[model samples]
Target chain A: EPEVTQTPSHQVTQMGQEVILRCVPISNHLYFYWYRQILGQKVEFLVSFYNNEISEKSEIFDDQFSVERPDGSNFTLKIRSTKLEDSAMYFCASSEALGGYEQYFGPGTRLTVT
Target chain B: DQQVKQNSPSLSVQEGRISILNCDYTNSMFDYFLWYKKYPAEGPTFLISISSIKDKNEDGRFTVFLNKSAKHLSLHIVPSQPGDSAVYFCAAKLGGYGNKLVFGAGTILRVKS
Candidate 1:
């Protein structure tokens, strides 16, 4: 079965540095999403992307966060300045249809900021 | 406030027995519910899902039961095996154009052989 794939299984960056997490969602998927899980916490939604524009975002997705579909296959989340609290497991997901459809998730990228 | 809640932090069941994992939600607008399984170092994997229109949905050894009136749902694994041990997460989504999903804290299930 085809699955979503994320690059740099783990990322480590300085507190004030910029970092980008990349994902390649299923080829045929039209909707993409980003979620994060702080250690020992529930997974939280960050943002959703469709047609190269953000569909919706959570309060957690603030000014420092941005998402891009720079190419047909790549979806990326960039943090302008990493904070210690930003360290978490970032996951990428995709669904074939919209609205309450089952989403397929990637292995996730563990971001660690010091 | 947590829209979705899994009260049990962990559960252990003997092999070949039935394992039931429970979940509750505070949101009435959530019409779709899903269960996911996760192993260490991996993301949550889709297990099964049920719509409010149906009371139950089953696939092989996995079955999901939803109680819309009670605002609760449960996943039943019959004849559980050691391989079934993992953290199970319950997620809810509002039907229609709503794309955001609210997930519970998760319940760690240990199916001992």
Candidate 2:
């Protein structure tokens, strides 16, 4: 079965640095999303992307955060400036239909900010 | 405020026994609910779900029961196996938000053999 794939399984960066997490969703999926999980906390939605634009974003998705589908298969989340609070596991997900099907998740990328 | 909640932090069940996991939510607008399973170092895997219009949904050994009036839901795994040991998360989908889902703190289930 096809699945969403994320790169850089683990990353550690200093405070005030930049980091970009990449994901390749299932080839036929049309909607993509980014979520984060702080240690021992519930998973939180960050942003949703469809048709190359952000459909909706949570308050946690602020100025420092941006998502881009630079090509057909790659979805990326870039953090312009990282902070200690930014340390978390970033997950990427995709769905074949718009709110009609279950979204498949990829193995998350653990981002650690010192 | 937490829209979805799984008050239990962990549960243990013996092999071949039935395991019941419960969840509650404060949001009324949420029309869809789902359950996910996850192991260490991996993202959550879809388990089963139920729409608010229905009271129960079953798939193989997994079943999800939703009580709209009580704002509560439960996931039942029959004849649990060791492989079923993992953290399970309950999530609520806000229909108006269009695919945006709010999740609860996961319940770690240990199915001992």
Candidate 3:
């Protein structure tokens, strides 16, 4: 089955540096999302993107965070400044349809900021 | 505030036995529920989902039951196998176009032989 793929399975960045996580959602998927899970914590939603615009975002998705569909197939999340608390597993998901449809997730990119 | 809650941190079941994992949501606005399975170092895998309009949805050995009145849902795995061991997460979503998902803390399930 087709699945979402993310680049740089793991990333290590210095504090205050900018980091961009990339994802290639399923080719036919129309909606994309980014979520993060701190160690021993529940997965938290970051933002959702569709039609080249942000559809929804959580409080966790603050000024430092932004998402872009740089290309028709690539969805990227950029953090303007990485903080120590930013260390977590960032996941990318996509769905073919809206409302009650299953969203498929990528293996995830482990972001470590020191 | 945690809109979705999975009270059990973990569950252990013998092979071939039935394993039931429960979840509850405090948000009545959530009209869709989904269950995902995750192994170490992997992303959450979609197992099954149920709409608020329905009470039950079955897929092979996995079945999902939703009780709208109680704001509760459960995932049932029949004749569980060792490979079924993983962390199960219950997620809820609102009724809209491409809404964000609210996830529970997750329940670690171990199906032992």
Tens digits of per-residue lDDT for model 2 on A8-99? Answer: 99999999999999999999999899999999888999998888899889999999999999999999999999999999999999987755
The candidates, ranked best first by lDDT, are 2, 3, 1
Which pairs, if any, clash in model 1?
none
Candidate 1 residues B1-113, lDDT tens each? 59999999999999999999999999999878899999999988999999889999999999999998899899999989999999999999865453777899999999888
Compare the candidates by DockQ and give the number of the best one: 3
Estimate the TM-score of every prediction: 0.97, 0.98, 0.98
lDDT tens string, model 1, A1-114?
Answer: 999999899999999999999999999999899999999999998988888899889999999999999999999999999999999999999987645378889999999999
Model 3: how far residue B90 lies from native, Å: 0.3
lDDT of 2: 0.94
For residue B79, what is the lDDT in candidate 3?
86
Q: List-wise, what DockQ does each model earn?
A: 0.74, 0.73, 0.82
Superposed Cα deviation of residue B37, candidate 3 (Å): 0.1
